[model samples]
Target: MQLLLLVDNNDRAFLSDINLYKNEQGKFIPRNQCIKLKDTQGREISLLSHIDNSDLYGAIFTKFTVVSSSRFINETVILRGTNKHGQDVFLGLLLDKYEFRSFLDKEDELCLFISDLDEICIFLNNNNYLGSGLINERSDKQLFIDLKNNMVKLKPKMNHKEKFCTSFRFFNKDNIMVNSIIIPVELSNIGATNTTTVTLK
Candidate 1:
């Protein structure tokens, strides 16, 4: 997992080969796990994390303290930020809605922009992703994904299957299911089309 940081000064920072530890008998234990990350500048802050790697959207991590340390406590590949949702650690990942998408690419981007079909354009909205540079602005958040377009940003990687399951169950842990939507975008010879419909009840 990679570690990404966002600074108050609008600088992005990153740390590869991120390590996590729990003070077991005054010894920091390293647990092998995978997560996503990026970086920014400001005072470096740290959190103790236990990343649960059982889903595709990303890991579910919780914070703990094993020692009385400064801001730097333990290291993990966790994405931290703030918005209307408040400060939280996000195991950031997009839903797998694109059939022609490769998981390897854009794995570094952790910012998520969830919308229904009403909006034809999805902007990266950097103001929303405070303190993190790992996730840059995206231009394509529309229902129609240009399959022939070589640029991956024009297409979305949102996973529709996880909408009711992983998304509802996981994000609800923090009561953060506010602005997120999980719709499936399927590609056809005619172009891109949404196979699922979302209705607010």
Candidate 2:
């Protein structure tokens, strides 16, 4: 996937290369990420000869915009941010439905805006991630997913052919039938406050 990212703070604007790859263990690894700036006339901003402080604290990642391909239409891209303070943050990506419709013809381009990175950090400060950042909520909630293990023998209730999928099954280990709509349960809710752990069997 190719993404054009523009990160801008009030005083500075920079462009960077964001590359994603799969490792030998079948895990996604991101690297070659750097930021550079240029003028309106397209002159490369020199990043050298500057005092460097590795401690990045209270640095707000504002006006974050990302544009990628149609292959990333419904898929979420995992993002990790290391602030000046050495704090790590996790961000989940959702394809902006409004922008998806507005830029259909240009499906190769996907855009997302992130206001405050800290809010996302607070939400995910405790959770672990599975492949592709598919998070499993640690509450008594289940989201429907098509799998071979939990299929039921009964006929499907829906009439629409497009709605019926081959891998239809119950949602959890207990074989609970998921409701029509899925509700997300977070750590702060229901007297539970812990990071959701993801373990691959």
Best by lDDT: 2
- What is the clash tally of candidate 2? 4
RMSD of 2: 16.8
Q: List all candidate RMSDs to the true structure.
A: 17.8, 16.8
Q: Given candidate 1, what's the lDDT at residue 130?
A: 15
**Cα lDDT tens digits for candidate 2, 28-108:** 232322222122233223221231221222222222222222211222223334443445432233333233223222322
lDDT of each: 0.23, 0.24
For candidate 2, the per-residue lDDT at 106 reads 32
| Residue 105 alpha-carbon offset, candidate 1, angstroms | 16
lDDT of 2 at 30: 29
Question: Which residue segments of model 1 deviate by more than 4 Å?
Answer: 1-17, 20-88, 95-201
TM-score for each model = 0.19, 0.21
State model 1's lDDT. 0.23
